[model samples]
Target: MQKPYLEISHVNKTFQRGSMLTDVLRDISLTVQKGEYISLIGHSGCGKSTLLNIVAGLTPVTSGAVTLENSHVERPGPDRAVVFQNHSLLPWLTVYENVKLAVDKVWARESASVRKDRIMRALEMVQIAHAMDKRPGEISGGMKQRVGIARALSMEPKILLLDEPFGALDALTRAHLQDQVMQIHHALKNTVIMITHDVDEAVLLSDRVVMLTNGPAATIGEILKVDLPFPRRRLELVTQPSYIKAREAVLKFLYERNKFVEAA
Candidate 1:
């Protein structure tokens, strides 16, 4: 049998502070196929971001393992790129420069022309090429977020990790960016794992939505497969039976079983 593209086996995470050991994730195991879009949905304390961090190799897993292409993931590398809720663009850099920084770091051995192409390609992918010369402070929140995504994609990472990338935006802006991200994923076929609390967003964007139980030691509660076809339309999905079923499944998991608590 062929091995999974990304294998997360029996993973657990814990934190130590002032002699106190707090268990975060417990024996979580997941298999991600190539080009799949996975969403992690759960209550505030359920460690969705923590799991994403572990997968990104930004945080250590206390036990078990995460492997990509049969190789163990032990540290942060170019293979996995992350986009956070807050755009992490450098204050001194323009949108172009922000993406260029990542390309330079990851593809340092390439020629200057190659790096520039990489930067421009990513900016254009996110539809931020028009604002490439603008600084983050000079743009709207949505544009800044697009730059953050462009920087992450410029590295040509094998997997994209998004942690609430649109959470800070207004409803309309959030919807627009969600469409952009979905379209990008459809085109690039990049493997993605996003952390989101929105049931509608999860069903809208994911191939499978993995729900987490309430924490101090959270584990996967359910995995709802969204069998909807590609190029999903948000307005049409509202009345579509398949979309509504998936959304209700997530809602039932989040509220009826998991009892979601909003983080302060």
Candidate 2:
């Protein structure tokens, strides 16, 4: 078998709170293949976001290791780009500038024209080329998230990490952006790992859904393979029997895990 594109081996994370140590993640292990779309879902505070941060090297792991293509991950690099829950765009800069910042940072040695071309291409890919001149404050939440997606993709990362990237948007807007994201993934075929609480969203986008148990120290509760074919249609697929079955499996895992945590 080919080596996994991204691997997390027996990872754990703990935080210090005053005089006490709070364990957040415990013995988490997962392997994601190239071009795979994986979603992590669980109750609030289940360390799903923490795990994404660990993958991005935005947060340090207390134990174990995260590896990409056989090398250990110790710091952030252009090879892995993250889209945060909040669209972390610069309000002072135009949407084009916001994306340009990332492209320039990662490819600073390239000529100016090359950098500009790359940024514009990413914006076009996200269908936000029309909003290139607008600031984040001037765009809708969904549009800002698109800018975030554009910035991340502009880096041409090996893996894309998204932490609840549409969690803050309204229902219709979130649905629309979810479709846009799925379309982008289909076209680009980049490896993607997203942390989301939306079961329907997970079913519509992922190749597999991994659930984490509730945490003071969270761990993987279950992994459900999504048998639905892609390029997936959000509305049509959501109503299919396979999609319903997959969503149920994920929901049951999260519900049962939360109950287990509550009783402990």
Candidate 3:
């Protein structure tokens, strides 16, 4: 049998504040094939983002390991790129400059023309090429997010990590960005592990939805396979039985498991 492309082996994570020790994730193990799209979904307080951070090498695992291509992941590198809900673009830089900054660092050995091509390629991939010269403050929220994703993509990272990347957007912009992401995944086939609370987005964008149990020591509660085909259209899937079934399954799991959620 072939080994997993990326492996998270019996991992655990904890935090220390003062004299208190809080267990966040326990015995969490997952195997992801190359070029797979996986989503982590759960209510607030779950360790979904923590797990993503571990894979990104932003934090140390209390125990166990995460490896990519059989090499241990110990620190943040060009191999893993992350995009969060905030976009985190630099206020002083224009859109083109924002992405160019990453390309310059990752492909610094390359000549100036090569670097420019890298920056333009990523901007075009996210359909933000025309806005390259615009500053983040001059653009809308959705455009800023496009720049953020382009910046991450410009590095040509092996794994893309997203933490509620679309949570702050309006419904229309969010849907549009989701489509852009799906198109990019189809074209690039980059391995992705995204943190999301949206059930519909999970089912639509993921090959598998990895749901976590309620926290302080959250673990995988269930993994639902989305048996739908690629090039999924949002409007067309509204009445799709398989799509409906998958959506309902995720909703069922989320509803039954998140009982601590108090009704507002």
Residue 111 CA displacement from its true place in model 3, Å: 1.0
lDDT of 1: 0.92
Per-residue lDDT tens digits for candidate 2, residues 1-264, read 988989999999999989999999999999999999999988888798889989998899999999998888989888999999899988999999999999989999999999999999999988899999998989998889989999999999999999999999999989888888888888889999998888888888999999898888999988999998787887687579988888888877866647734310
Write the residue-wise lDDT of candidate 1 on 92-194 in tens digits: 9999999988999999999999999999999898899999888888999999999999999888899999999998899999999999999999999999999
Model 2 accuracy (lDDT, Cα): 0.90
Ranking by lDDT: 3, 1, 2
- Tens-place lDDT digits, model 3, residues 1-264: 878989999999999999999999999999999999999998887898899999999999999999999999999989999998899999999999999999999999999999999999999999999999899999998898899999999999999999988988999999999999999999999999999989999999999999999888999999999999998999999899999999988888888767746421
RMSD of each: 1.3, 2.4, 1.4
Model 3 residue runs over 4 Å out of place are 260-264
Residue 205, candidate 2: how far off, in angstroms? 0.2
Per-prediction tally of clashes: 0, 0, 0
- Answer with 1 or 2, whichever has the higher lDDT: 1
The TM-score obtained by model 3 is 0.97
